[model samples]
Target: MQTINCPRLIERVMANTLESIMISDRRGRIIKVNNAFTRITGYSESEALGQTPAMLRSERHPPSFYAAMRAEIDHRGSWSGEVWNRRKTGEIYLQWLSINALEDEKGYVSHYVAISHDLSELRAREAEVEFLAFNDPLTRLGNRQLLMNRLDQALASCREKGEVLGLMVLDVGRLRPINDHFGMRAGDEVICTQAERLHLLAEASDTLVRLQGDTFALLRHSQASVADMTHLAERIIKDLSRGITLQDKSLLMRPSLGIALFPQDAMNKENLIQAAESAQMQAKSQGRKMFRFFDHGQHSEQQRQLIIEHDLGELIIARKHTGLELYYQPKMCLVSQTVCGAEALLRWQHPSLGWISPGEFIPVAEQTHLCVRLDRWVIKQALQQIKSWQQQGVDVPSIAVNLSAHQLDQEDFASWLASEVAHEGLNPSVIQLEITEGAMIRNGEAAVALLEQLQGQGFSISLDDFGTGYSSLSYLDSLPLNELKIDRSFLQRIDRDERSLKLLRAIAGLALSLDLQVVVEGVETDRQVALLSQFGHIKVQGFYFYRPLPAAEFRELLDLQ
Candidate 1:
């Protein structure tokens, strides 16, 4: 066997090993270093040799830390922990280091050997993770966690200073609609631009945060009163109402703002956020581009609505197999006083809550993608009923089902509707879709194209609740509408209001000119019917003819007719 030189063996081991190896003489001067030591410290072996390891010390540790490390090494012969060191480039980095003392045969310390692994990347990654936990990925604004922390700190300050704090929750009301229209990239740009605007609006003492998608929170301390909060909310609303240009297209962000004052509206962070959100909801309900201060009554109503919304989500999921029914309201031709078509309206047959009104739950459904499912379910049920009615020898001409903006804009709704209709072996002409003016316009060009597609497939489309929304006359020509239903509001005053009469005549004449049939809704009285019937061949539907009925009851009405 060949005998190995001990010093050469030690040098080979140090040179081959990956760990940074440094050797110091008994007097604490660096005697040697391996290639890894030079690589990690950005120092050449020639530069590092003869220099003490203290030259690489980052000065981050307290004297006590070094003293404890020394004490451990003296007592236990080795010390292992994290340490901060500086590279030759003057950049500081963390290192996991293990140090051992080497002794001669006399048992006195002769040299110190330290093995270190560079930990800069790991430390940076840890710091980045911490930052991400409190920041929004899209806007780099403080996130929900940071929002809560800031609110907690503000509440504590309010307590100490005996001053009021204003917490405002802002919802970009147009975000979803804009996303549907322009795409998510533009939506993200809008959110980022809004964040910058909000950041500018915030004072140095205020904390502005993006809590979640299209939702932001601002905490303002040292508010003089609730009025101050209101003013701030109004300022936010005004600033956000201005249009933002994205991809060279102008987009408006109508912000609905809610303000809750701490120590008055809420005493804690969660409750404060809840109250501000409640107020923001109230603002949205009142109108878009507005602000509302938290009122106890509104808050309570919001809480009740939240419960209904939660239940509504569950109800929608189980609607196909369980708690859902269609109620038909007969639409009668005014001249014959005979039913021409029936409107299919949704009713939630809640097991515990009994009959929940569509007016209450439909809005809740519209807020989520569940509205698309609900719309599809309504069509499927309506078409299935039509087929059943025809089989039983009941002549149901057409069934009018209301359409929502969300459902209409769904990726492939037109094709899906056609597929569903064909699957039931039902004639497309036997189904009429009623869309409100607001929903129609909200969907814009996409809606016009879908309406034309449905019309091309022999499906009738009706512009329902016509006069309530701000629709341009140019849109009427663009859309493939088969009918225009006069809003019930106009009919309510048609008997007395000459202006209402003239407006009705003009709308009916316009529909006729466009070759679209005219329908009048909410004909609850004989006088209203008589007034509405005077308009040539217009049709009528209301409580006066028949309240909405169950499928069986409606079938009975068909039989009686």
Candidate 2:
């Protein structure tokens, strides 16, 4: 086939195309230029005709950059990538450029064709995105992502040089209140000013980053020891606690710092930050303007508590799937010596964590708002067991479920309990609620009203761990309580301590005077049980008679009764 050369067709296409197109002779002198070339380079075709492509050199790139680019194009016959070039007005801009050598007959290079797309706007947008991703826009400080990257690098350097890397997490405790009182704009100003102050305190090798709202992180590279970390944290706390002025008003800011060390607290980036956060929590707990070093034991405990909290959250959602459990310890009448009732004790049998005591997990649950759900589950389980026992013709009188302060503090707790009990189809008289004296004391009037409402609904209310808290007799007289349970601590020392017996007797007398049934807990020894039997018409509960039993075992005990 015979080929036809269409120079005019090529010229027409090049002139109308968006991409800048230029043809240069073998000596690299521009031979022709299209409209797009003029548009992108800001030079007319007439002005560019005799000029070399070197006229567009941005000078941003070093000599080696051009040399390597030229070598690649010559050897490969085509090259394409990002390049910086100068416009006719001497302004530099980025471009995606492609160049190909045009060959003459016998494969001799005759001319070069170059095409380029303006990338200045695209590059600018990319830079903005990258900046936003790794920086806090409000404070212009490195964000958490950037902090993680720097932490990873810091850890690697520490390992290589046998140095310690210290990480400090600072929490601005007053920022929330400041934001609430002064507005977000003022809060932002405080943050930016704090960042500037923190940046000024940082060493040349140290990195200051913003982790999240009112939280900032610092990476101290090549630290000497715990002393170095503590010194740095102290300096930061002192400097930051001096306060900043926002809107012409001086406001004091409290700084709580957590410091974690390399190869000591953690060896990786994530754990290092976590350790620092743990220490920061400890610092905050100890009061503001203070710092705490990451203790291995404390971090482990924090992590374990975190795991328990997480597991409890999951268990709350999956209670029906066997995440939570309840064990019952029988409460016996002193005169009859048979099972009168039992307390439904919350138990957690984590699939992997095994059995966790209520003492270990209950506080965590209460703190995380999981207590209400957990308490509901306990009530449901207790009601189910009660129904099962009733169907089996067992004479179990009542099953008491403990309520946390968190539960009683809820505004609708009484109604919620009544609804749950009714939903389970269990008679309210057969179910009892046990509340600690502390809970009643903390909740005060709300607790009393709820307890009275529940009592009015035919649910027996017992004040558990009665004498442990400093609840006055006046307060106890006003509570709509059916029973007062003597705390285990008094019973633990009942056999040996005369004072304990006097205290127990006084408490028993108080319960009797108030027309409340008295129940003594922790009746472990036979001697103590005998001593407790003297109280007459009292109830006893503890390990001597029965340890807490699983639902199945408790059911068997009910059959035996």
Candidate 3:
């Protein structure tokens, strides 16, 4: 400290610093520059000497900008701010520049010292942050934030012009299963492919956004008519329906679209998005590649569903099963002309809503974790009821319980069912598992494997609601099915429609040839029953014999039989 070289230390510090340092005389001619200045401006110290800072000026700043900077420096004796500067290579870059004036003993400016830090990296980082905030990382499409901003602007413009705005929310079906089966990379490929296809369908005025996983929104900035919206929806569905090839394997995508109109369906951005989402839910429920328009009636139904979902969650959290009941609908074998088995149907009686049908609440449950809990509850109650009936000498041969797709997704479902049956001291064959084709299709090979595991454990597996799904015949031989329950739609006109009757006969015969038991559902009239009776060795289940009844009533009926 005693022998510190002050001037040498200052020069070393300035040379070592990363910031570009420059010095100019009172006449504004370059006098000195540090190494960083040469690195930043691509100029040698010899070439820069005697030159004014105007050599580094960029066209980005107007003449007024330079005048203001000069005024600030003259008034304050210093200036510091961001400046656009040009390099010797003619490349423009941003820099944070600070200049300080040095005065002599006479109190007049004699020299100026300037320090500059390149802002290219900082500016790039800021730009990247801004882009990510408004775009989906995977698809590089506008995200929900950008969508909201554009939607607000569009809505304001539409209100002023007295024009309608159409908002379409689209969902890609079965994407979750794809992600579960194949890896997430496959899922990303599918999402990118769909986004490209949707972008291709978009017009220049339209705004396409990726709201979240497997969901996209399209804002119809032009031609917001009902017919135009419908046509766009149709084109989207058809285009997405074509199989996307991933690693030489073709993956099919079914897109469902929901259209909601501004001013008619919703007046605000949030409400409009919700309306479109609700309509999309409806479209998915109706079928794949389908589109639905928003209606007040559907909105009311959606509100009720929300209430039901909330109440169901409360019941689940409280572990309250008193409101949940299982009704038994008897399945009679035509060959024996007696009650052979009964189906356990779930019913809920909400304290506030009075009675909620399965048709109304089941779909809602399927969308949440409530479905798995509900399925387990149904199985446990059915098993306990069967033991109670047997103890009372009610000779109910077998009981069928419907399983949700969520239940099939559980890895331990088969083992859990086996343990439950064994705990009740009942043969596994006494319990039949009724599964919808849609459930099997959703779970893919996993469902088939689960069914085979259950069958191996002596549990009977019946394919429920057949002929209404996509691949019934293709699955007949592969699925470990003991019975096929023909859907009621096939029998709605069986009494008068000869083609339906013949088709029903063909299905029954097909099941018979495969040595599988056949069950015909929805035989409402004696004529339908009489026509179905012609098929040998089949079971009939519908209101024609008996509607679903409470357990006590069902036990009494079994006792009478």
Candidate 4:
């Protein structure tokens, strides 16, 4: 190597460096400071020399903190961190400081060289950009970006403190319908109303964020337990469920609240959101006007549902051969014990996992939009079964398969049903499509009028879960329905609860007055059966007799008795 002037090269490099490098003697007096030091810190070497380094201390740092830093540098020979310091003219700035101990020939401490970079403008720019990026323009609350950041910070805090934080995903419910039905001006008014409500709901320390599409998030630094979060969730439900008035017409806006708590729901940001979102999803799935907290089982259950959603299409293809099977539970005449029909339930017999219940896969099918295909399969299978039973000298009434709302939403719904029944060469009267009372509703007159065509096709229609829907009795009076099935929930409580008994009696009386047959469900006890029998409306089914049984088992029963 060429001969090099090592000491001169080091001094020149230090003088030109972007950072301010200064040397202080063991007594803490500045011995020398470089040109960069004068330029950035606004102090000339003549002015800074011989002065104590204390002149640069901003006093924001605790005395003990500096003492500890000095101790670390004395023991370890170097220290690095962001610190507050003062420049000339008393301007305070953030400084990234790094100090290295200068050694003597004998390894004794000789002096120290500290390099500092001014961070004032940089920090200000950062804060401004962060605010622009993460704050909502309208409400000035945290936007989705800040909500995400807040969640991350909360996750980190939870990791350190071992406490749970709760996230409430709030949806502004009535805002959309009002905006759509009324006007955009009404929408803005509704949003402002909700933003004010959100501000009032949150503690001063808590962050309320405006997520997109009129949704908001309220973040809580919950206590160690989730009980506190649950109590808060209930309070939100009660508050948001109250009515709001616009132009003196009462409008209802309820939150579909989903909560996620740390450690219990999830440990990380993504997972915590998913847990909260999963709970909220469950709430919305149940009809979206209440609070739902994350349950461990719900998390695992959602995972299982996701797996089914992804894999069910493939599962359907594989099972299309030998694994696909249908089970039917009999719906009998109340007193005759004669089967009126059966509801088809899909079962998957995995080669390794054995049978999978409809309860497990049906929801998955619904979520993945696979239910339409599954429904098609059920229709073909049920008609074939009815044909087989008819040929075997056993009388089987019409077959019923539960129709999902998505199934009805298909553009070819009535045509598809007609085509499927025709392709199966089955009598239209032998097949009945059971639509939930909720799903049977149509917003457009064209949609409800479409159902009138289905009624003309020699097919029977039954209103499922007749009492648990939004339609008034007057609305029901206009619809053509051959039968009405009382929800299992009402009849199950009739034997023990007076309120339920009266509700059931009223429903039975109304169905009869409308010239409709009523089917009571969930008759698990003989007393329940006797009560329905006494009322002369004994058409029922539940665990009292049998859960759904496979075709083979049900066929064998037909042979035995």
Candidate 5:
């Protein structure tokens, strides 16, 4: 091994090491400093040379702190601990400093050596970890853990002051569908935008928190009365009602708020949150842009819906179609008095709950991607049933399956649907896709393009519940559509109001002039059928002809036809 020069090796080590090193003479003035000292303190050796350590003293430590450190160094000849020091630029920083006294042969202190390690980076990392524990990384809002902590304190204060505390949970209804239609980045933008809006609406004393995906909470301790909470919820709804433009595409976020009061809803944190969440579900079930307070009577219904949603998720995960069945309702062509097509409707028979209404469970499914999955399942089932009917020698003309807006928004939905039909060895013309006008309006131009793609594949597209939505006449001309199914509401008033009758006739005439097929739904009376027959070549679907039946029964009906 080569011999190492001690002095040269010490100089190289001092120059390269990250820890700042300083040497002071017995007179207590800095005599030498390593390169790290200048780098860490923004001071060159020349500037530091004749300066005492007092030059780096900060106001954070009192005179006694330094005095004790000096005493320890004097008695024990060494001291090591954290210190607050000022850099050459006058910025206060933290450093772990270790000092030792160097003595001569005479046993008297001659020089002092000090090593400093910057603690700024370490301290920053610690703070960041703590922050992430309590805040949502995406929105930078308080998370559930922080919310529960704040709630406990707020409730304690409320109890002492005899005041009420309101906890409001707001659910962004269309967020998941937006994520599915747009991208996850777009979904993140929506969430951050909503969080900023909520921050602006929150009172100074109110604590805003992000619970999880598309759900946020606000704890209001001041002005927490029913009237105050109502006003806040209205403001939130109004503020969020405006469209958020993402990538030049305008998207609307519908908010549903649920409010639960302390002592009234529940005294504990968990129960209070549960009550607020239950109320939020109820608000969503009622409609979009709605708010509701916790009601004991509706709790059971909300629980049932929760169970339904959970069970639906399980079924989708397991790919089990146990209780799910597609019922066929025949559509009659008045001109031929024969079934022209059959609308496939979904029905669920839960093992214990028996038959659950679509109205009850569909909204629950719509809250998540379950609705999209449900729509896909319906499409597959309809196609398979059509193939089965054909194999059984039943002459079913076409099968109509309802599509949700979420399904239409999917980037590859049209291709996937066409592939499904082709997989069944059936022509696309045998399948009819029914979409609501609201779905078209919500999806904008994308929906129209998807419909055109499906139509180009030889599939028929029908605008369902026509009069219930925007009903833009422009859509009638622009959209690639084969049929229009008028909502039943229009026919309910037809027998009593002559204007309603004239309006129906005008709509039917306009559709006929455009060479589009027209179907009137929910015809329950003979008088209504007689009135509808005058419309000429229109199809009718409702209880008047036949109720929705199982596949076997529907096959029998097709056989008789």
Candidate 6:
């Protein structure tokens, strides 16, 4: 049977199709033109018949572009693409084009035909869609898809270059409070501000991508060293640590970072991302405002995490094993030099570790989603204790109960506080909620909104560890904060360091100006107490007055006072 030939059909389609079609000699000069060519170029057959298609080149592409394109066609005998071309009216339009070589008889002589369709409108629409798809609405940074695409490209480039590509992934610490407690509008401000902060921290060559929610991805072509990565991460942490004043409220920053290096920790794109993510999980597990690197012994770390997770779950729910105890430290009145109030701090008496510091177990509980229960328990216990003190006619000033960023992120924490107060038959204002300044800033918008909500409900908020953070005073002015507790470090140095006294004076002065109550923590001696007196009307808590005592011992101390 004779084979059916297709070249004749190709010729007919190229010569008469709707798409602009042209025939050229082997040298690429136009030898013939179709009707659609005249229609698209706004030139009659006479004007385009012999003119080369290059005459329609819009100059958007470089000269070398056409040269390389021609070379490809010469070597392969065909080319197809979307290229910009100019109409006779001088308007630049995009064209979807296809070209093929035609040969006859001995297959030694040749001609080429090109078919093109207008694609300008399609391209414009695609661009608009692409923008929406690849960017975060609030931050205007690359979203997850864009970040992954870039990571893929960076991995490919790293493989080609035989160099290490560093990936720095950051999770804004304490950001959940802003989004969960405050409305999303307030949370948007935090996210937007973070983008600006990251832009300044990342090198010019690095790509900064916002990876959905509070996560960000940074890709560097080459890392100078581990120190350089750490320096960059620190810059990000410090910049974001600055107070965020939104509307009438303010917030602080807290973040955690993880890093993975290409060709070192991982070579493939998936492995690189997994390593970075694993490191991030480790950072989050440690606490916010921390950085960690990928460890090859990921399985062991995972096993450790599993054990901690198991213990945390059991600790929160299993009251039989959980040695939940409340500790009290007296807060002294600066002028009177006597105990005016006390901070109710939580301590876990681990049957194994003897005393598990709040620092360790709190973070573990928060990450494992056990903090909600633990925080609720602490609040209830504190409120009940305060109510009991009041019932005994102890008439103590408000008892301060510290709150965690994770606790504020809980949807019902504020209302839960209200219920706890009502349950204990105590005034909401009698229990002041203390949160770290670092938590406030990192959670900027969310924390501020939550503060206002909790404040509006008659609960008091205190800026804990005031001067040690970026700016607790600024947040105090914006948030409905009732007190500013000077960090223990500042007070410890007060007697020996004049600078600290002056600094404490400045903070106290600012607190007075803003009508905020001032409290100095960790005052250990008569000399420290005398030095702190210069600050005026400040409340003090330290071993100099009394160490953190258990409930029974604290109640006895309360009777004595």
Number of the top-ranking candidate, with lDDT as the measure: 5
Q: Which 10 residues in a row give candidate 4 its minimum summed lDDT? A: 442-451
- Model 3 scores a TM of 0.62
Per residue, candidate 4 scores C-alpha lDDT tens digits across 382-456 of: 888877887888766667787777777777878888887787677788887777766766434544665677789
Give the candidate number with the greatest TM-score. 2
Cα lDDT tens digits, model 3, 1-561, are 589999899799888999999999999999999889999999999989999999999999999998998899899999999999999999999999999999999999999999999998899999989999999989999999999999989999999999999999997777898889888998988899899999999997999999988999999964599999999999999998899877788877888999999889999999999999989988998886899998779789779878998998887767887698999999999878899999999999988788899998888888776889888888999999889878877776889999999899899998898899999999998899999998998899999999999999999999999988784586789899999999999999776789988988998999999999999998888788878888999999999999999988888888787
What 10-residue stretch in candidate 2 is worst by lDDT? Answer: 315-324
Give the alpha carbon lDDT tens digit for every residue of 153-177 in model 6: 8777767777678888887766678
> What is the number of backbone collisions in each predicted candidate, taken in the order shown?
0, 0, 0, 2, 0, 12
lDDT of each: 0.86, 0.86, 0.90, 0.78, 0.91, 0.79
TM-score, cand. 4 vs. native: 0.49
Worst 10 residues of 6 by lDDT: 299-308
Better of 2 and 3 by TM-score: 2
Where model 1 places Cα greater than 4 Å from the true spot, the runs are: 1-6, 57-76, 152-163, 171-196, 221-224, 234-256, 263-275, 278-561
Model 6: how far residue 438 lies from native, Å: 1.7
C-alpha RMSD of candidate 4: 11.5
User: Model 5: clashing residue pairs?
Assistant: none
lDDT of 1 by residue, 275-357 (tens): 99888888888877998888998777667677778887776686643678899999898888788888999987776667778
For each candidate in turn, the TM-score is 0.57, 0.74, 0.62, 0.49, 0.58, 0.46
| Candidate 6: stretches off by over 4 Å | 1-309, 318-321
lDDT of 4 at 408: 72
| Cα RMSD, each candidate | 8.3, 6.3, 8.4, 11.5, 9.4, 15.5
Clashing pairs in 2: none
Badly placed stretches (over 4 Å) of model 3 are: 105-108, 171-190, 238-253, 281-290, 295-310, 321-347, 358-561
